[model samples]
Target: MAKKWDLFEGYLKCDPNIKAAEVVTDYVENYRSQAISEEVQPIIDRLEKAKADYFNSLFDLYEKEAEYMRIDRKVKDIAGVNYYIKPVVDFSDINLINEPEIVGAQVLTTRLFPTAVKREKYSYEEGAKA
Candidate 1:
């Protein structure tokens, strides 16, 4: 019989940073547990610092994942059919005409982020008035 591995193994195998992220997460959880269980003030403070370090590491990992996703989107758009990505939410009533632009406004408005189609939904009273 052959050994069977789950799909998650493929994801974990793709990036070394993911392993580091997992290690940091374990440390964070351990420090959190220690902070909760122990009553010593100094030890709790030290654990908090350790937890912060783990959080910072996880943030860096997340940034790398974001960069990877950006590049992956580009590649997929170039090679595959143009389509909307997942995790989209529809906000049809919000107006952004007077809103000030922030950094990466173009990317956010595009397929990478959730789109807000500025339009009103159909209502009985509004329809009757129209």
Candidate 2:
């Protein structure tokens, strides 16, 4: 089955530095500030409702999943389960507003390098030859 596209994916692609919560806030604020025509207002309203429903469901799922994990961990710990063992319930790929930013300074640090060199080692003639 094809994967469902996430709403934050587009925003993150545009600006990787933005947090998921910021994307939702910006989207809602932008939608509210827009002046829609009478003919298209109903469609816009329906779209807004749909987006709200989608986000609400996602948030609900996130909360439940988190609670389940916490309970599962506690139960396992009480039962003397091995620390290296994985959780029984694997609920991966759930996107939440509280998730960390998509991009970080580490990403840039990997691609960039220092260009400076000591003046004593720097030679104008050698540099020109290269």
Candidate 3:
């Protein structure tokens, strides 16, 4: 799956006027700002805790309820991105954990596109005169 950064890179490549390095730097900075913001920090913490609890419960044979609790938790990414976390089942022969699925991420591209240029239209006579 193509990431948001990859899309930004492609956008920069399509527009010769845009500097790739500058745009990438700005994008990274924007991501960092959002990651550190108060609104997103708690979500990050909760995900970390969930992952830890899930693993700890998985090792302990009697912690089935805890494992289920971890699975029930809906952990979203910092930018409100939702990715699938495969639930580990107790079945030995059956492998329920599949490949990591990347759902989607919210991209902030307010300044990515350049301003539209006005084009002049001319009739056949106007073109002939020109």
Per-candidate alpha-carbon RMSD to the true structure? 26.0, 22.2, 22.1
lDDT per residue as tens, model 2, 14-88: 766767787678557653344243224645665598679978987787677686887777777887845554554
Summarize candidate 1's per-residue lDDT along 1-130 as a digit string, tens digits: 1123233354457854456566456547664455445434544565598679866965775676676776666766776665554311212333432333323554445534325544333333343221
What is the alpha-carbon lDDT of model 3 when measured against the actual structure? 0.49
Which candidate comes out best when scored by TM-score? 2
Off by over 4 Å in 1: 1-39, 79-130
Give lDDT: candidate 2, residue 76. Answer: 76
* TM-score to true structure, per model: 0.27, 0.31, 0.27
Find the 10 residues in a row with the least total lDDT in model 1.
Answer: 87-96
Question: Which candidate should be chosen as best, given lDDT against the real structure?
Answer: 2
Model 3 stretches with alpha carbons more than 4 Å out:
1-35, 62-97, 101-130
lDDT of 3 by residue, 20-89 (tens): 6866786687745654553356546755986788667556734654566564454423224456544354
Residue pairs in candidate 1 whose N, alpha carbon or C atoms collide under 3 angstroms = none
Candidate 2 clash figure, as a count: 0
Clashing pairs in 2: none
User: 2 or 3, which is superior by lDDT?
Assistant: 2
